[model samples]
Target: MSKFFTYLALGLLWLLHWLPLPAFVAIGRGLGWLLFWLAAPRRKVVRINLKLCFPHLSEAERERLAKDHFAMVARSFLERSILWFAPEARIRRLVRFKNQERFDALVGQPVILLAPHFVGLDWGGARIAMSYDCASMYAHQKNPILDKWLLHGRTRFGDQQLLSRQDGVRGIARALKAHRPFYYLPDMDYGPRDSIFVPFFGVQTATISGLPRLATLGRATVLPVVTRALPNGAGYEVEFGEPWTDYPTDDLEADTRRMNAEIERWVLTMPEQYYWVHKRFKTRPPGEPRIY
Candidate 1:
């Protein structure tokens, strides 16, 4: 099934690349509607996540957040598609940087650039690769056409791409050894072994341990970054936070928990912007039922 989707994605990539800019955006919007409004996989997932995260919010508020989440998802998809095919000048014009010099200072050092799953995340990753040799891990989409197209777009700025389930540590080590920054979405669930249960949105949720592991192995500075969508529905603000000074203890589980907690802290700053579509609480700890 994955192979079949790969083939389909390849075809879509061909069609999308050849299409005019407006046409590409049209196609993107259509796909967004299907996935976000009609099919609504992410919206459904987010609704469950929101209910868990904001239990105190009224039913009407939860419903509003769910609807807003879907709209944000749709807007993000279309803007990302535009980034894929748009000219470099156009992309630069749309995406602005705030407090980026701090990030620039860490270029030579092995850095674990942490980014939330926001609207312009791919573009932010691309911007990093363009400035410095960088590698990022992306979850493989079921649609082959979409996956290939996404990889093609991500690698366009000369950064290598790694699948999430691949030898993530090894790939990251190679990038670090070469003094290239390694990027990954630390908020999502990886698997039972690769993750640890941590407090998120007032519940213990499973989160990938890659950030802590990578930071420890490479002695990398963990920098939190977020790319927020602007009101015009076209531009972005790529904001970078200060690096984490605290190091993990000898215990892996404790360190993982600390790392996930830091991520949760930053994510709540713009809770509405989080990629709530993810099944964040998919893997519960022993004796606990899955939250979603």
Candidate 2:
């Protein structure tokens, strides 16, 4: 039954991919409107996250932002078929890189492409993998058939490698040592095991400290990467910022805070594009209440 549903969904995505850009955008917005009204659980999560992050905004303002966010999220989901299964030339034309030289300079060095969870994140990864062999970690899906398809779609370009989260950091470290850049998405709540309570939008959020540790282990440089979905189906822009001069400092907690601060800055630039549907503050510190 699960396999049947998965195939049906995949078939729809394949058909959607054939639509023109404007038609795709229109359909995605319609779907997002439906979801905003129908998906109560996810809408509540987004509302909670926005309220926690932006206390200054009035209730009505936050609600407006939440609606816009839902629209972008739906658009990202529908457009992913292009990234996953579209022709190489089509994907190439759709994703543009802002600072290609900065990324090109890290050819032989251990590097981490620190990408936050923006709506166009997967598109950013696909754009990078078009030219470089990068490594990234992915959570396994329960459905085996879906998992295999995801793994194949993400790594089909540039001989990229996708490591399972269960494989531990050793695979990523090895890939880094072999001079492949790590496409590290380090902005999620993975519990409080190796995470420390840090100030994210003035909230004590549990953020993973593995980023600094991984960089230290691989002796890699950290470069911030951001992707923006252009308006009117103009395509995506993947911008690679300058490498951090002094990162992974002696203070792991401080380093994690700095990482969160950077993500906050980016989120402010485009609040709608940031991944707000996630329960980021789910893992609270001891003696504290859950935000979600």
Identify the leading candidate in terms of TM-score. Answer: 2
Q: What is the lDDT of residue 34 in candidate 2?
A: 90
How many steric clashes between backbone atoms does each model show?
5, 0
**lDDT per residue as tens, model 2, 1-292:** 4878999988888888887666767777788889999999999999999999999999999999998898899999888778667898998888899988998888899999999999999899888888888899988888898887788778888888888888989899999999999999989999888889999999999899988999999999999999998888888899998888889899999999999999999899999999999999999889987676
Q: Write the per-residue lDDT of candidate 1 for residues 55-109, one digit (tens) a residue.
A: 9988889877766666566655645555576667766766778899988888888
TM-score of 1: 0.83
Which candidate number maximizes lDDT? 2
The residue ranges of model 1 lying beyond 4 angstroms of the native Cα positions read 1-37, 40-42, 139-143, 159-164, 251-254
TM-score of each: 0.83, 0.97
User: In order, what lDDT does every prediction score?
Assistant: 0.71, 0.90
Predicted structure 2: clash tally:
0
